[model samples]
Target: MSYIQQSFSVQFEYKVFFTEKIFDTANTDFANFLESRAEKGIRKKLLFIVDDGVTKHHDYLQDQITAYFENIDGFELIQDIIVVPGGEASKNDLQLFYWLVNTLDQHAIDRHSYVVGIGGGSVLDLVGYVAAVSHRGVKHIRIPTTVLSQNDSGVGVKNGINYHGKKNFLGTFAPPAAVFNDATFLATLDERDWRSGMVEAVKVALIKDAGFFDWMESHAGLLTQADPASLQYLIRRCAELHMAHIGGAGDPFESGSSRPLDFGHWSAHKLEQLTDFELRHGEAVSIGIALDSVYSWLTGMLDADSLDRIIKLLKELRLPLYHPLLEIEDDQSAIVAGLEEFREHLGGQLTISLLRAIGKGQEVHSIDLAILRKAVNMLRDKW
Candidate 1:
């Protein structure tokens, strides 16, 4: 056993900035960030990849971005801002992934140059993966435009695309250079988009902050109506909780099987695929939370009053509590098969996060199928 040992550690730090109209000429936040990263003699390039859905709503976005960067020194912005389709379908297209990679190559986007992804979670995921694999890793920035992306996925280090109809089947743990969360984009989101996006907040509050959960419960009406103040607070709180878990939990890359942040995500992932992605990620997670909450009560892990409060809050927010596909038909049912897949994704035991109280979450290595079935039926029949 005569060999040199390998030992090294890399520190990753990035800021998630909250702003309105990030591309506005008067907004110096984006410009200031670029200025700070500029090298003395190097004129780094920036390639902007946008979501087509965003362009449709904000038609002046391209011109706005170009003009904003015009006066910024030490950086050259690529004029041809590429726009691609958004939503989960974007992650399912391998050709789209390669196309973007080829675009990066043609434009000579090197490691020093930055790839800025501006869109929802799915588009950001694709762009991040592309940047991560390109030149072994390129500097990438995120301008998340939706509630889901801004509060959860946009602030995290995971970047991935769906492979063979599986959610995030292929991906990497590449942190971005920085993330700019622009709240203006939330204004154009459809009711479903904004409504389903809040599930992440509910999830994080359930697992970590009972006080936050109580706040949400009190503001359920205002949140359901998408009141600006309530919505902003929800997004900020959720992002903070998510960031704290990622940085302070000692497992930013998820080297272990315990994923408390993924309390309701196991079935949520499968439900998204099972419904052909008709259900929004948040919507599916809403149902997953409901089912798991009921299951927790059935298993005696959570009190009945806590379960009632959870169910009531979800209902008041208008998030779904059940989907037909979630019904356990048999041992080989599609939803049931998801357990094994989820276990494989974790690379160890079948760990699932269940609530012990409003703000307390505990991880279990195994689940009782019979009780799980009962939980599903209870949700379907009662709620």
Candidate 2:
């Protein structure tokens, strides 16, 4: 069977666009797309908004992207625009969406023009947000560089950046024209970043792919170490897990994570806010997952083995199960205060995904200031 079967998925009437073998196939897909556009008399220049890291080798991959399609529409149009360094750090309102939006406006890019994001989740998020708001939305294509983007952020079509210390505080629900996921980019990543991506893979499995999580438990070390086989399995499974549920949920653009099937996210987002984005999102989520699962156990929603198993998997992956920053906090009161921001930011009641049992998850109102305090205290003592 083609890797396409392993690489992409579409569901529930929501259009999902993807280039499974990005590097090998991107140019051909673009050529075919441009040909159709030309036949239809569509006039549009492509903006190549790329990440700095992708260009680090400037000698090869980066320049190759621009050179591959230096001109299209038979060279009649200017056909060029490159944006800034891409990342979650770059996702700040100042450098990413704002810069790209202004750049497009200054260049007089119209609805006919399109933006192509070339980087990991951050670039995809920020650029997609810019494209959505530019002239009331324009065409945007996502070339997700990292695993986090490919399996989770990239395919989801939610866009925006962190603001005022909140992650994804400002953004929109705009799907892209397409997405490209090249396993080759995995080669460019170091160990730390590769593990960051695995956190998302774990989250996907925790949500619905019980079997995937089972595989993850057995291969956590290998996955952390960047074993290609382990990495490939995690990527494809994570992508499939999310696509299954995202296709059925309410619009992902409305904020508050819009879907708290993201159980560990409440505390996770708070931890990130406190860390000034230094803590990788996946790291925060791993900690959050642990805390949340412990809460589930405490309340009789889960038993000891399930909680231990979850934390064990994370530890095996080398992801932290506790927030080191929480150590400085005076008491549970400080921790409770941190979680409140997550509830307030979403502009809705606190919606948390909780576990009734392993293989079963449910949402509930407020994690309770008191219960959260207890959980924090217990985590501190245990860690």
Best by TM-score: 1
**Predicted structure 2: clash tally:** 0
**Model 2: per-residue lDDT, tens digit, 79-132?**
444747755688775755566777888777777776878788887888888889
lDDT accuracy of residue 283 in candidate 1:
98
- Give per-model CA RMSD: 0.7, 7.4
Flag clash pairs in model 2.
none
- Positional deviation of residue 208's Cα in model 2 after best superposition, in angstroms: 1.4
Highest lDDT against the true fold, candidate: 1
True-vs-predicted CA distance for residue 101, candidate 1, Å: 0.3
Per-candidate TM-score against the hidden true structure: 0.99, 0.86
Lowest summed lDDT across 10 adjacent residues in model 1 is found at 329-338
Candidate no. 2 TM-score: 0.86
Name model 1 segments beyond 4 Å from true: none
lDDT of each: 0.94, 0.71
The superposed Cα distance between candidate 2 and the true structure at residue 135, in angstroms, equals 0.5
Task: Count backbone clashes in candidate 1.
Answer: 0
